[model samples]
Target: MMITQVRRPATQLARLASLPSAASRPTLNTPWRRFASGKSKSNVSSHWFRNSFGFALAGTATYLGYTYMNGDWEAWIERQKEVKKEVIDVNDLRADFIQEKRSLKSPGVYTWGSNAHKVVAPESKDSDVKIPRRFKYFNGQVLRDFKIDEKSGAAITENGDLVQWGKGYSETEYKPTKTLIGKNLTSLALSESRIVALSSNGTIYSLPISKHDQGNGPKLRESSWMPFWGRQSTLSYRVLRPSLKLGESVTLIRGGLEHVVLLTSSGRVFTAAASTEHYPSLGQLGVPGLSFITRPSGPVDTCHEVTSLKGSKITQIASGDYHSLALSNDGRLFAWGDNSFGQLGVEFLPEHPFNDTPSALPLKKLYRLSIYSPKVTSIAAGGANTFFTVDSKRILGPEEDTTKVRDLGRITADTWSCGRGVWGTLGAGKWIHLQDSPIKVKDLSGLGEYDEKTKQMLPIRLRTMSVGTTHVAALLNNKTNLSAKNTDALDKSSDWGYEAFWWGGNENFQLGTGKRANLARPAYIKAPSESSKTPEPEARLQIMPRHKGKVGKRNVSMEQRVECGRHVSAIYSAV
Candidate 1:
């Protein structure tokens, strides 16, 4: 496949002189004498004048006759480009990652709220879900890990398969269907029209909700000359090429309204836009010069690293519709993108409101607790608001194990909110315009119980909070018995029962509290009344397994796990 470069005839003259040939020997002696005469009335060297014209003619003739100069070289160059464009699936996932635990089957899920289609429903035609009711459409979390937005949703199932559903998928199937069966996907990120999946081996794949939204065809097979018989399988996904440029594989993936944020194995944060064909991106992609004015030209399938966060090791990421939040290992949080709604949790100038640069929020100044300084433990984000849980609770021995709090969505420290106020998202119980700074949620702050039996306040905690687009729900944890000491025997988040409380908008009864009036302060969401209950469909009713404890095992059950999406709310529990 080698194509030699063509050389001009003048280069042959240099080799001709080194060959000890008589005709090619230097003859400068006669040319210098002619120049010294000055009779030619010209500044040009007589030696060059006599030899240059002939050399130019000879070089042109020689180059035109060269074999590679015809068309083979151009074809060879194109072949090399095709080779560079083709990517091989290396399956290069890093080995040193946290191991995932196996989840039990037939986990029960309760859902309420509405989207454009109102797919999440209670029994019968009741529009309002003022009470927590089991969602029978998808049969609970058949998919272990899932994420949903205002328009679409994606999930990674227990068997490492991918499932998708929502409005963006209207051109395709609108219901939850098994889209990818054998990818062994570990995580899912859904944007407007695309679903980015992260495999167990760290490879990333982008799948389109509709066939027309696909960026490019699937990667070429191993042999460049392989033929297609059109008999194998449907080309539904494309391999993303960020790792080819970043030189690192991705470990995590999260979705925003129109942008997706992923963390690499090296702790680097990267962001990419949804399919530009179906959605327009603001500065949400986090790239400086790639906004509306300079929208992506070709397919929007590459991940651009956040260079603004170069030196910091970002451990976690969360995002709203147009803003993004990155949490560092040292409890430092950085905010960027659209701030007009104050979703970035920081102040901006009047003239210039939105910022694309990553800026750190002053966690140390805004929030601090006594005894143990508030170090951020975890972060959660909604359409226009964010939730930060900071715990100073330190444990010394195995009795102090609390790592499951995050997996269970339980918070041990005070949580705060800052964003738009149209839907009472700030939990301030009033209709304000916006909040650009951290404000303590009254129901979630300064929470310490008083045990009259001990004549003192008990500090045992199991509180968990879920924030939706307009409302908020929490499991107060105030009802749990105080053990005063962490013990292996005192387990089961449900045994330590939770009091359900909610606040904010009630247009769709998304707050799960019966009645239409909005709740400014936290109120207990009632269980479904016997009179309001409809007959259970034979196809949907089943007897859940009894909750039992294994002698040496932990995590008996998550009976009331809270979840919130855009105008949607749900509480999931184990079977």
Candidate 2:
């Protein structure tokens, strides 16, 4: 105990001890490294303890890192979800904008650069079969009738006006040449003419063949071969009479082969059949019994107060090669004269004379063929064939049912027929080859090949149609066929398209195929100088004739229509 105090150092020494000299400071040379001395053992033990503490701290740090990762997973997931939602929202908005644009467009109205209607030009048999320049049509006209003459080399109107392809003053205003030069018109029938000009006032006039073509003027002379009567303006002219009438100031008249039909401003229909008192054995008068009689016939009057039959109201009268068709005031159609082929419709003929005055034969039974108990809307006649339509329900199936078609109590019947061999007129493909019965043209069949097992029921949508002694012409509303939708009639490798088709005799290029050969099936007709093509076979339907001209606005000529028999006549309304 006494010795312990003896070794105590001074204050300065104590301070010095707290701050050990550089040399006395703990050297790296420690006993802990020796691995042998007791002091070394103590140092080793302390070092081991310090190392253990550091290792424990590192382990704790690692454990804390794992814990942080596991506990913060929800936050990380939420952030990821936020980013994904933003991307999804942008995509959805873009898709919505695109869909909206598509819905705003209009459906089918403007066809790019085609007539959409009418047959195209016929295939050229030679370079001599030149294609003509076509003009875009004005509204309201649906290709009523047309004609082409290879000899004239120029297409003119039925009124004898130069409507297309000429030089200088005779040319049209636009790209295609269509000029209307005043000429003596012989008459007026739709787009055709037979009216003549009154030479006195340079006024165009029309009359029955019984009337005189007299009067003299700068525009016309009584003896002039042409029959147009009117004054001329600088560029064109003003019609003194667009149509012809019976008395003083009548304006329009129509001739149906042996019968002459007249229209008055008062909306009256005056018919004058060639009476059997003037001409002898002439088919131009009336039916056979009256063929030798040649006097004006009648003013077959109606009680209805209707004016525009829409082609229905006694608005028109046509004669087949040997038949007659009359359009009534309310669209009721009446036919008489010939009925050999049932062109007079399914009816019984009266064995004896029915009346002294010209009265219409009632044909209410014709409605049985249509859906809407058809009211005769328009009528077209062929040589030995006749076509008439009534406003009624559409017919497409074979049931021949009318119950489902009757809606307005009034319907329309549009039909056509033709004689045998000369190919007559009905548009039905090859059906009239030698048959004498009235046959419906094949309006439903297209020009393409099809199996009998898989045939489509086509509807005839004709705007206008006409017939010749050995041929027929028509203006059809271009329509799409629905046969492809019929599973039983589907053509696996063939996709039939919409087009203008014609069939029957191609003789004299009447079918416009530029060939004199005959065609029993429908053939495609091309447009002059046009690249567009008609769909073959299935798309072809009738042998349409082409005539270029204007109607309702001017004079007409005798050549506009050719009268051959007691009921046969051909009209070129497009002149």
Candidate 3:
């Protein structure tokens, strides 16, 4: 050992080099890492701190990169700020209106029963009873136009002012209250939780419905109202022009549970989901099987014109819970969207049994159905059913008047129904559960009385019809005499008054028959007044003097209009 130590200079130099120097190496006992054996705690801590700092810097860089790449960093920062709160003053939203003296002879609005929200007039002193009540607030005001949904109602006065009422979070308007006073409203549409109004100037206004305080359960609530006139407003309404490219004007608008269908003056049809969440389900927008590579960010804020209905002059549109129906000027019908209960009026196939799986059927586009011989005059859609009013006579040339043609002493208008009939909503007959194609409603031939002298039944022509979630209300022309020779006399004495018939679900007395039982066949609904004849037509005085006029005795009401809702019904009449 002594001899080797004297000669091992290379080994000695290697050992000296292996030992760490104080300048370059850390001490054994350091605060960061004290429990160490042979390892220098400071060195270990410095290495660990360097590696950890590098990892932390890398993690921070990665997060920043991710947020920047996704474009959410700014939004996240904005969300962290304290937002200024604002309150809407109802008085500011209202106009300075003075009630003018109204005539006793003006038309009245009558609503039957209640739904999730009560339909009582806001001016009504009685709060307990909520069934078949006349709105006294509308007594003096002439209701030029009106629309209703499950929980709300809107009307346009003859003066062009808009009136609205019903249960919403903002206010529970039991009575008709004036709104958007200076702006003349031409039309309005109501959905489950929203109201859309079209002004005479071609502007659109929307208001969010609050659901917390006034319903069976809580639902989505919008905090403010907006007017879509020229520019989009986050709190107020937005203009639906350049964004939607709806041209300069909109002619008609129809709203469903969560969507809206618009008809432009140029005969274009466009649809929009009420909210952004529904954009993925754009089939409701009438663009079937539409797929987007990137998720939309409130694209429904604007609307897309339905290309499938191109070149067709769409005149009318009707919407249900999850489906839509469009009628063209050429008497063609197009249906699309949900067909879970055969509401689309398309033939049922085994592969496409229900609309539960939208991908399988991809019923995003509208389809024209091969309806029967008679041309369709009007269409109405319910929650799960569709109703069509067809001209009973064949297509007439331009020189002919179909109204002049009488069939077997009856001027009949056929009503065809398709879709879900679980509650007899189709009104075809008892035990008919569902119909995929339009079928003429049965037992409608006897809508009028039988003429004993002619040994034939008098005709009852469908004047106008409305379909509810589970019921139907039809205004029928009850012609008493069918053999009159004078066309003028026939026109004068044809009893232009309309009788209302109701069928289908009556669980809430929506049939207005003072009963709550479902009706398989159509049943007569009594008029609000017991008078044998309706008030004399005001137009009659202009033609014939009051004393010398040959006024026809009409059992039905005059200027009659019927509208139905989820579990409620309404009638407008001039007493």
Candidate 4:
């Protein structure tokens, strides 16, 4: 339509220009003046022909040029419209991003751009249905990690299989029907196969796996799994320092990015190399001087049993990408190694290069940094961060007996996420690069609240969360149990009440049981709840404003395979 209109103007202008002016030219019928002008009939014909031909030629050229120019104009107009549409699309997308970001700030779950999914807990029923333990158990590779259910003594692998450990107990619903051909497992760690399991009576076993054999079938060696360090590379003149001594057996194993640390129940700490000469990866090993040693050079350096620390027993230890955390029974936490991101949670210490050499400076000369002095109950370490949950404010003396004391419940300061880089893993979208102090994830306000009148601006309680290489998986306690009709916890019915919700990272199936889409925040996982008997919709990310209604309906069932780092382990309390 616009093209036709544009061509009409050029055609009209060419037509007007081609017309002769009657005042400028003599009329052809005025032949009396033609004799005096010496005009002939042939000349008259030639003149008429020239005028007609010239007019035709001029009009054709003008029309052709105008057509070409009109075509360009039309093209420009269309290009402008396209550009405007693109601008609008970009603006809408940005606005959606901002809205989703704001939604994440609410206490309930929300999606960013990843494949986050929501999970609801089942509603309470007056009558109890007995689900056989055997039905819950299956035989599979304990890929990431395995944990024993405290109540049932059933071992669950990373692949979601539950295996019964004891004799006669294997007949329960939680037990795998078939016998597992390999190791009688205890516990498993992700990325590395440094399995920590105990024999029936109480003998601790550690199985060390070489990197080359990560995919091999489960093979258990009945000795303490200790990794010894050989001499440093001769090609480099730099002398590597040794951290943990392997002469002593490892009682506890925690895997980090590239490095692994072993802590004896007796309170001694040992570590081993994470990298090889072939390739060097970051977070692969502790600082150069912090490498693992086969033998201690001296008594002070020897990895002997620690009986000191004011008689406080060492209960737990956590290793981060570069740092290590130790928690004693006394509730005091000891940290060493990298301080760059403040994973140590120690404040006042001047920031230094995150290496063993820099952190090895004299204590008196180095600034002492303090982060939190909470009476720690447990600690967890991630790629470049560490988290510690504490028990109470008033730390009890090691000699004090509290078995009879009423549990006042633990006081956790608030959840915080800290790390390096710009991958948007930390829930706090604004923070980037290394952080020396822990920062609470943004948009996590109002967790565990039941009513708008009682909504908390800050989370009072957070439980059971895991951090991946780039995302986080957390199971939050709603603080109340009720029917499925309650939508306060992510508009989720009671069916999803106590289950789990995943947020962050959609590129990989990190969010679990959802369409592979990256999310900006947390969302409910609805697919797992759909029974195989019912027709289910196709899987998709829940980040969009409206859920796709038809996709899943056509496909009765869809199964998604997720590869968790070796295994996904969590601490659960069966109430």
Candidate 1 clashes between residue pairs 3 or more apart in a chain or in different chains: none
Query: Model 4, 302-394: lDDT tens per residue?
Result: 222222332545677666655666677766665665666555554425545443421211222111322213444556666566555433233
Report how far residue 175 has shifted in candidate 1, in Å: 3.7
What does the lDDT read for residue 125 in candidate 4?
A: 21
TM-score of 3: 0.60
Write down the worst ten-residue block by lDDT for model 3: 539-548
Q: Write the per-residue lDDT of candidate 1 for residues 395-446, one digit (tens) a residue.
A: 3334444564332322246667787777676775666577888777666665
Q: For every model shown, what is its TM-score relative to the native structure?
A: 0.63, 0.42, 0.60, 0.44
Q: Candidate 2, overall lDDT?
A: 0.37
Deviation from native of the Cα of residue 267 in model 2, angstroms: 4.3
Q: What C-alpha lDDT do the candidate models reach, one value each?
A: 0.60, 0.37, 0.59, 0.39
Tens-digit lDDT track for model 2 on 175-258?
223433454333333211122222222243332211111111123223344567433332322233323344433334434333
**Model 3 lDDT tens row, 1-575:** 54345325534554455455879665654543545345576776797788667655655555556566768689757766624113334443211110000111344577775545545445544322233456676653345577765567777776677676776433544455665455577777666666677778777765554433223322323333465434322233344542335354787888777777888887788776553234435255666555444425554446767788887888888888777888889777778777767777777666664332212111212223222234567888878888876554333445656677444222445677888887878777764677776666865532556777778765465666788888887766554345432223212443233345678988777777767778877777544431227321111100000011121332322243677877777765421
> Ranking by TM-score, best first?
1, 3, 4, 2
TM-score-superior candidate, 3 or 4? 3
- Give the per-residue Cα lDDT of candidate 4 at 352: 52
Model 4 TM-score on a 0 to 1 scale: 0.44
Q: Candidate 1: TM-score?
A: 0.63
